[model samples]
Structure formats: C-alpha cells, structure tokens
Target: MNLFPDAVEELRLRTREFIRTTVIPNEPAPGERLNPAVRTELRAAAKAAGVFAPHVAKEFGGQGLDIAHWSPVFQEAGYSIIGAVALNCMAPDEGNMHMLELIATPAQVERYLRPLAAGEVRSCFGMTEPHPGAGSDPDALRTTARKVAGGWMIDGEKRFISGAAGAGFCIVMARNDAEDDHLAGATMLLVDMDNPGVRIGREIHAIDRAIDGGHPHVHFEGCFVPDDAVLGKPGEGFRYAQARLAPARLTHCMRWLGLARRAHDIALDRTERRELFGSPMRELGIAQNMLAESVIDIETSDAIITKTAALLAIGERAGSSLSSVAKVHVSDAVFRVIDRSIQLCGGDGVTDRLPLAGYLNEVRPFRIYDGANETHKWAIARRASSNRRREVEQGEPYRADVDAPR
Candidate 1:
C-alpha cells in the first residue's frame, strides 16, 4: 500500500516538471556563475510558477504543503543543487522562515517575517561561532546581549554564517543572564545587518560553489536592538533553535537524497556505455555493486525522511534522535554514492568536465551541518540509555533487556 496520499503524488509530479523544465535550464556552467542575482531570477520564476516555498503556509503566499507531502517536493528540488535556491527553499532562509513563523511577534512579523516570506529580503542565523565560543555545544555560547535603555546590546563574533553577506537582517543568539538555571542560558535577537555595530567581516569560501549570499565571518560589535527584537521569550533561545533544527535537518536529508540519486543516475548512464577491457563497465562486479548500494541508500534515505516528516506533522517533536540518525545515515550514504559515482567516471569525475566533482564537493558538508555525525550518535545513545533505565525502574521490560543475556 502507498503511504502517501494522492495529493502527494500530484504534488510530486508538478514539482518534477518544475525541476526538469524551469530549474535545470537556468543552472550556469561550472566556472561561470554569480551570486544573489542568479538566485533572484530563479526565485522570481518559482513565484510565477506558483511553486515557491512549498512548506510555508498558504496565507503567506506559499503552497502550505504538509510535511509528508513536502518531502518529495523537496527531494525533487534537490536533484539540482540550485533548485532549492530557485524555489526559495534554500537553507538559512528556509530554517529562518520556520523560526519567524513560529515565534515572531505580530510587529516582528510585519517588519521581518513578512518581507522574508515574500522573498523580498534575505536573512541568516548567527549561531555557530569560532573556537572558544559556541560551536558543537550551544551551551558554550559566549555572545552577550546586555540589557540597555529600551533595548539590548549584542557583542560577539559569529563564524561560518551562511547568507551573512547579503542578509538584510540576522537572528543572533547571545547569553542573556548568567544567573539563570537553564542549561544553556541564551536569547535570540533579530538584528539588522545594516546596524553600525554589526559587521560582515569576511566571506568564507565553501566547497559548494552554487551557494548565494556567501557564508561569511561576522562580528557583532556591540550591536544594539530594541526590546522587541527578541524572538519568542528570553531563555528560550536554545529550545527554539533546536526546534528549528529538527525539520531543517530533515529537509537537508530530503534534498541530498535527490542529489545522490542524480549522481547515481549519471554514473549508471556512463557505466552502461563505457567499454572496460572489451566489456561494458556495468558488467564489472565492482561497478555493479556500487550501483546497487547507491540505489539501496537513496531508497532507505527517502523512507526514513518521509516517516520523520509524518512524526513532525503530528506535533510529536521528533527531536534530534531521529533527525541525527537520518543525518548520519543520509550524509554518509549520499557521500558514498557520490564518491562511487566519481570513481566510476574515472578521470572525468575529479575534473570540471562534468558535475560529479562539484556534486562531491557539495555533499561533503552535509556531514557537518545540522549536527555532525559523531555528536548526534552520542546524543542518541544517551537518550536510548535513559529511556531503557526509566523503563526498567518502572518494572517494564526494556526491549534491549529482553534481548540481553541474564
């Protein structure tokens, strides 16, 4: 039986058409490309085609697709690295939209959220910081937002911030009060990127060349914001950030799955025709094995992502546990698939003659963003242990214990 409804299939077909016709034609050659402008044109086309922001609510000029239905649509967009950009569903912006919709006050919504959802402005999250600041551990955040007259002053440096260069505003995280008992004492403030105290320090060259609003090293030199700049409540920053991350990571998995499929398709096409020692490459045992593994990985990734999306739609707060598992599995799977694709292509794979080299470079960061594989594994294991301990204490049989030797 099909898990998804008829609407999902219809949406998938529509999105596939959009991707094949509208998106693919616009992609620039490997070496010749520009920033923001290329993305702008694509966004306009997506808007005109009525496929922009598939996940955002319909009231906000989006399709308002549910999580289950949106997963396939996002996967289709992932087929082309630039597809998400064209559809206005790219990162930082996509995650930022979710946060603003959930927490922004009416005034904040009017000022920031509305423009963002309308695709009139670009934004970024200023969370990840350099060494000695918040990196993997958000609790280590050292950026401070000191209460001042009618507002607050934020001071800190944010590194590896995507979309910082062209962002009209930034959602900044900073320590609110040291006395709070919360594990991670922080607050999120929406700071105008144009503020004198806020500086775009430098652009960080990333492996992915298609990225617009380039990732940059940012410095918040006593940046000031009115009291209303706070998103949600104080001391709730970490909670809100984590909430945004779960869905964001799922979307990343969905997109990368498509990318991996694209790479595998390319490799499969090449192998079918290429002669190897008087035989077709597809006849080679190693080539066949790689292709089979790629197909399995992509299919598995799709199943996990769709199920996770259903969990989120039901308001279950699926958490990092499932998302982390998906992250590690999908990232590693996609990387491997792309690596094998490149290997199959031989010298052409590593060269700019084809897209495999760029695809390989792009998929590499999927392992790090959202949450690194190692960190998520540790968190998942701890959560599993805690659940098992609780179950045993309550005289309930733990699944692991049931399978364990006395």
Candidate 2:
C-alpha cells in the first residue's frame, strides 16, 4: 500500500491519516449525500492540513502534483466518499479544474480556475444530454451555440448534468455549424450558471448519494456569453474533452480503487471474526478463495492504474487508448471486488449496517459514465484491429507465440 514514489510518499501517508481521522468522522448518515455546507467545512480542514487540491498548480492555490503523483494521494482521499470532496478533488469540480487549467484563457483563468482551486466554487461539465442525444457518444451532442451580435447564444437541454444544481458555471459543449465563424464544428463555451437563461430542473436522485452535488437536468435557453467565454480554440471542444476525460478517467479509477480496498478490508475483518461450526469462517476453503480472488482483483487493478498513470505522466500519445483499457478493466475489477466483499459480509452487506451497499451503488454507475465500458471495449478492439491491419499490410510475417508478430 505504500510503494508510492518518494516525492508523494509523505503526502500520501498524510492524506490517508487525514481521511481516517478527519473525513471519516464526519460521514453523513447512510443514504445521505454531502451538501455544500458540510463540504465547505471539510475543505477548510483539508486546506489547514495542506491536502486540498493536490492536482492544481501552486499558483492556483494547490499542491501542484502532476497526474502520476496523484494516484496514491487521490486513492487515499477516496477511502471515504467525504474524503475526495474534503480535499477539493471530487468530480465535476476536480475535472473542471483540470480542464480550466489546461484550456482557459488568462481572463478565464482569473475568473474561473482561481476560485475553483481555492474551493470557493463548484462547476459542472455539460456534455451528456437526454436520451437520443450525447450520453456516452459525445459526437451525438444535441446542444447548439450560435453567434450573436456580441457573443453567442446557447440553446440546449442537458440532462444528468452532475453538480448542475449548485454549480458556479458550466463548460458546455455545443455544435456550431456556421463555417464562417472564426472556427466551427464542436465548440466549448464557458457559461455562468447564474446567466439569465440557465435553469436547473429536477434532481435525478440517483442510487449513489456520495457525489457532492446530485446530478440534475440543466437547460440552457438563449443563454448568452461574450466571445471571450470560449475555452481554448474554436472547433476544438472534442480535443479539450479528451484532455479532460483521459486523465479524469484514470483518476476515477484511482478513487474507486481506494473504496474497493476499503470494502475488501471490511470483509477481511468480518471473516477473521465470524465463527461457523465453531471455527473461524475465514479458515474455510471457499471463503479463503473469495478473499484471495478479491486480493488478486484489487492488486491487478492497482497495477494497471499505475501503468496508465505513468503513460499519462509522460503525455504519451497512446495515453487515451491506454486510459480506455484501464477504465474498463479497473471499473469491472472494482465492482467484482466489492460484490465479493458484500457476499463475504452476508446479510449485513445489503443493509446500511455496513457501507458495502452504498459502495456498490456508487461504483455501479462508473461502468456507465466517463464513456461506458462497452463503448471503451469497442474502441480498444478497433485500435487493436487497426494496428494489426497495418502490420499485415506491411508484409510482416505472423507468429503464434506470445509477443511475436502475430
């Protein structure tokens, strides 16, 4: 658990201790999510402990850890649902800060990323829409933005927009068909949530209650923002999305892995104590196998996460494809580990008596979000096929042995 690099080892340990002592003590009752008020308090404590916003730059009031270094730190913070938010690293805020840091103009940075990194505000990334719209396929985005006299008019309805209810702003993805503009195609626009045209609808009330702001319906009707509101270049929304999502996916894996470890630990404690037929249950063969299998799952998930993190740290051109691999594998692995943990806990697992049920609900959506696992699998398969196609066309001899030409 402590194989982190020297630079991050102390911070990671501090983060774990912080979560165990500070964040876990403040966990809300079962089935209740953390509200802004509670989150504000935790953020203050995290700041005092120098553990808030580890991913943002120091100039932005963060600890300035890069993507590779974030693995253990984020994992520690994710041991409890409250921990990530307390450290100001929960989505969509965490992902928003990352995107803003990468793409925001100076004026935009001053207006958005500064307070966001300081934990003064929260934001949402509005990419997914209602059915028949974007969802897992962002290319199917339904939002539209048209050039106006001074700026642009945004008109669209985004559903299942995480943190939309109380977000200070939103990074909206809208298509611009006008080829005459400075740039066309899909565009990223930063829209203030308080804009006259922004409206928040019903809270989705999803099964998971751990996200700081519950996902909700966000409608943008005639919302207008100056041309200065554009994030990065026009026609580069998808590019910026990849910039945000690729690393965001890895971080999600990191956090969920921590939760999965917690679940495993809970099961381990129970098995060691439970007596069946006047003997310790954990000593039985089947129960022992379940524990061993979960350990395998957790360790493998960690290895892939570490590898993908390294690829990300170097800004590897293959990072996105590798991220897809990590996302699909880690997501499934975490779910398997947690499901087994719950089974090991027996009756107590399904009830609020243990956090296993909530953990299950939280991780179940991961497969569907950040691009569904099925979508990632299809993409990964295509990439492999493309590589093989190139090899075959190049007249390279095929081999059946592992790591050979075949």
Candidate 3:
C-alpha cells in the first residue's frame, strides 16, 4: 500500500475531474439505473481518462491500487452516482473482483476476473437470501450444495442479489451438506449465469435504482459445477466472505461519502443564493450550524474510512470489526449529512429537480445494507466485552484482533 504519494494525489484529482466532467452529466435522472448504451460510453470515457478499475491489479488492466490508496480515489469516484460504474469500481463487481483476485486460480482469473475487471462482463455476489435464509446473520444461510460425483449440486433461492439479472456470473455461497453444521460448512463457488439449472426470478424493486442490474431473486435447482468451480476451499466460505466484506464495506462507505458531499455542496450553493427577511440565509444561525455540522460529518467520515483502510492494507482481515465500526458510523454520518443538506436547501431539496431526495433514498438503505447498524452495534459491544474479559484474565492490555489477520 506504499504507493508514491504524488501518483495517488494526481489520480484522486483526475478522478474528481473525471466524475464531474464525464459521469455526472451522463448520470441518468435520479433514481434510475444507467442504460446499457450510456454505461458503455462512460466506461470508454473512463478508460480514456486512465481512471478505470483503479482497485484491480495492474497486470489485469487496472491501476493496481491497494486498500489504503483506494480511499481517496474511490471517494472521488463516489461524487457522482455513475462515477464508480464509469471507473468500473461499483459494488458486487468491485467487491467480487477483490474476492476473485484473492482466491481465483490462474485459469479462473483469466475466465472471470480479467473480463470483469476489463468491464467486458458483469457479476453478482449471491449471499443474501429471502427471509429465514442468510441476511444479517450469514450462519442462517439455507442454500445448499450437495456433493456429486464430479462436482456439486447447488439448490435453494437467493433474494436481493445485486446484478443478478444481467450479470455474466454469480459468486455463490452455499452450505456443504456434508458439513452438518451452519458454522464452517459453507463453501464459495463460481456459478455461470447460463447454467441450465440456474433460474433468475423477478427483480426486487428496491429503493436504490441507480445501482445497475436491479436487485433480483435467484434460484439454483440442482445447478452443477465441476471441481474447479469452488472458489477457495469447501468449508471456508465465511472466511472468504470476511475477506471480501471488510474492504467491500469500506469501499461502500467511501463512495457514499462522496455522494453525501455532493448533497452538501448542493445545499451550500442554495445558501449562497437564498435570502430571508432581507438577510442572507447563509447568515442565519441555524443555517450556519447546519453547514458547520455537515463539515464535521464529512471530515469525521473521511477519518474513519482512512483508519479502516490502513488497518486493512497491512493486514487483510485486520479491519473486520473496525469495518463494522466504519460501516455503522460512516453510513449514519453520510445519511445525516445528506439529510441536513436537504433541510438546508428547503422545499426544492425534496423535489426531483434537486438530487437531495434521491441521495437520501440511496443512503437510507446503507444503514441496513452491509448489515444493519443495530447488528453492527451488537457485534461491536460483544467484541469489546470479550476483549475486556481477556484483558482482565491476562492482566495485560488485550489489544484484540485489530492487528491479527481474522
């Protein structure tokens, strides 16, 4: 992660310019996903701008940025809703790409990671499922993969699968029937979307529409894949998931923080032009307070993203719990920034004319996405309690798992 200081800064500035000049103009009306034609055009523009796939390895046609370096560049990409897509760093795809690079074999890298990082195809992560299945608690995952002679037979259904509809493939997580328990029995597999037994159900119309490949319901009935389809190992799905989520959640925070900044910028502009009772609206006490609070929110969010990113760069899974901390705080902070922006902008903010409402719609789910804030709070408290108990028993400062690779 010790990239040249100058290069990272230059990339960040270029990304900011690229987002403003290229992606935002072409951004579809608020609450709508980009059409294929527009997406293709923006990606080309991103490639020309030298900002595409900044997180992927350079050997794979990307800039080869590590976790720490990704913070500034990714936040810049977040400035516009379409910015991440243009740069080929959007979710499911970006997160899946990270996971692929971590465990994909040379051949798998060529078949999947290469095409995905190059923007030649799209992919989805199949973990979240319908109620009673895996959601906030992944241990409850119901998708099962039964052992077969040459491979596996995967079954069960998945809901809220981002990029499921038009994705080229799915990185699926399924419980190995032989494991007999919910804990360590799950496995990760790469499932081609065109497999005969794979069934894509109706799309789930969620609040965030800017996201491509609208979240859809998916089913796998006896879907079979050969031995090589297993991602890392038969029973280490949760570890790989932790490996994927720690950084993925932070990247989400980075991108949304940029969107929150966008909302704040929009509000600040309104304040300048607005006048009330023959006095400048910007001079009002509450107005000034809102602006100052948003500044605080933005700065603090950036600080947390930086802290978590640094922990992840040196030790891949080191930030697991800290990422939960980042997720809960960043998500809530960004939402408040957006909400305050809406309040500052007055009536126009709620209308489609301004993107504040759309920003709210997109960010509101973030509190629940990547695991709910309450769930994260519970996990944080449990970890703290466990750490305290160990600290007392050992009669030493129990630094906990933050430095250890989870």
Best by lDDT: 3
After superposition, which runs of candidate 1 have C-alpha atoms over 4 Å from their true positions?
31-35, 179-184, 397-406
lDDT score at residue 231, model 3, on the 0-100 scale: 95
Against the true structure, what is every candidate's RMSD? 2.3, 2.3, 4.7
Better of 1 and 2 by lDDT: 2
> What is the lDDT ranking, best to worst?
3, 2, 1
Ranking by TM-score: 2, 3, 1
Clashes of each: 0, 1, 0
lDDT of 1 at 265: 88
lDDT at 190, model 2? 92
Span of ten consecutive residues with least summed lDDT in model 2: 397-406
Off by over 4 Å in 3: 1-4, 179-184, 396-406
How do all models score by TM-score?
A: 0.94, 0.96, 0.95
**Per-model C-alpha lDDT, please?**
0.84, 0.88, 0.90
Q: Pick the candidate with the highest TM-score.
A: 2
> What tens-digit string does per-residue lDDT give for candidate 3 at 189-266?
999999998999988888887677888999999899998999998889998999999889999999999999899999
Residue 188 error for model 1, in Å?
0.8
